[model samples]
Target: MLDLWDGQLRDIGYESMGENGISGRRYFQKGRDNRTYHVHVFQVGSPHIERHLAFRDYLRTHPIEAREYGDFKQKLAQEFPYDIGSYIQGKESLVKDIEQRALEWYRDNSKLRRTTQEE
Candidate 1:
């Protein structure tokens, strides 16, 4: 899989696995010293896939939370310019909290949809 896109992207981690339910390959597009894009690829049955989707959907539906998250990111970027590790570390706790909330919300919504469809 990485081979297919190897020419276009810099393979940061062909087998870059994350411990926080985020195991997959990672790729990024870098031009000069800036990274323009980042991508993660997971298998079909990976739980991280659902977790990520849930987090994304939850953020989309929750404007205030999303805005807070965006603001935090912007602030972190400014505070840790050129220090990606610290930037990510600063948001680690918030991201974990959001992910927990998102997973719960996602499960509840799924249950509701299933019940509605059965009725």
Candidate 2:
């Protein structure tokens, strides 16, 4: 992947293979338009990643929570615009709660969908 990018990306374990219970890597890249993007490349299925995607999808569907998340992110950006780690740390608790809710929602909804489809 890095070779394909031709030095457009700065890889920080984003290419590491998920082996022996290890998770995936996250790649940071700069596009042609000078916009940065973070892409998580996973080798296998992980509950950790599942929860994250679930929370993200949950937020997208839940307007109030999404707004709250956006507001909190905005505040964090204002407080630590250049500190990526701190910005993520500041939202840890909220993210954790959302992760839990999202996992539960995923389980519940998946089961319901299966049942409904079967019927």
Candidate 3:
């Protein structure tokens, strides 16, 4: 991912930061409604980051689910246009639903090696 970002920055005539020991975590500024906001980027290998990437990949692979999620997000955004702080605040159940479903899928389809032999 850093390599990809390096290529992107080079393409845009920006220099790569070049191994600053920053752990690949980055923060940037964005503007919204005449106010600036800070955004943080999580690195690929970070523990919680994989869950988001996995969920995104799963949605990408499943068009129906992706569309459903997209619609849900749109509706949520519309309903909470001003309450950005509470945006997705109560969606823990939905998140857990996806997590459990994915886990069940992997458990049923993925093969695991036993570390011990039966006596």
Highest TM-score against the true fold, candidate: 1
Report each candidate's C-alpha RMSD, comma-separated, in the order given: 4.3, 5.5, 8.2
Superposed Cα RMSD, model 3 = 8.2
Q: TM-score for all predictions?
A: 0.76, 0.70, 0.51
| lDDT for residue 109 in candidate 1, whole number 0-100 | 98
lDDT of 1 by residue, 5-116 (tens): 5544444532322332344544343443344444566656766778888999999999999999999998998999899789889999999999999999999999999999
Between candidates 1 and 3, the TM-score winner: 1
- As a whole number from 0 to 100, the lDDT of residue 1 in candidate 3 is 55
Q: After superposition, how far is residue 24 of candidate 2 from its true place, in Å?
A: 2.1
**Once superposed on the true structure, which residue ranges of model 1 sit more than 4 Å away at CA?**
1-22, 29-37
Cα lDDT, model 3, residue 93 = 63
Pairing residues by index, what is the TM-score of model 2?
0.70
In Å, residue 71's CA in model 1 sits off its true spot by 0.2
Relative to the true structure, candidate 1 has a C-alpha RMSD (angstroms) of: 4.3
At residue 78, give the lDDT of candidate 2: 87
Task: Compose the digit string of candidate 2's lDDT tens values, residues 1-119.
Answer: 32343233345322322232333444343442222444544445544577667887898889999899889988987898777679878998988888889889988888999999999
Q: 89, model 2: CA deviation in Å?
A: 1.1
Worst 10 residues of 1 by lDDT: 13-22
What's the lDDT for candidate 3? 0.56
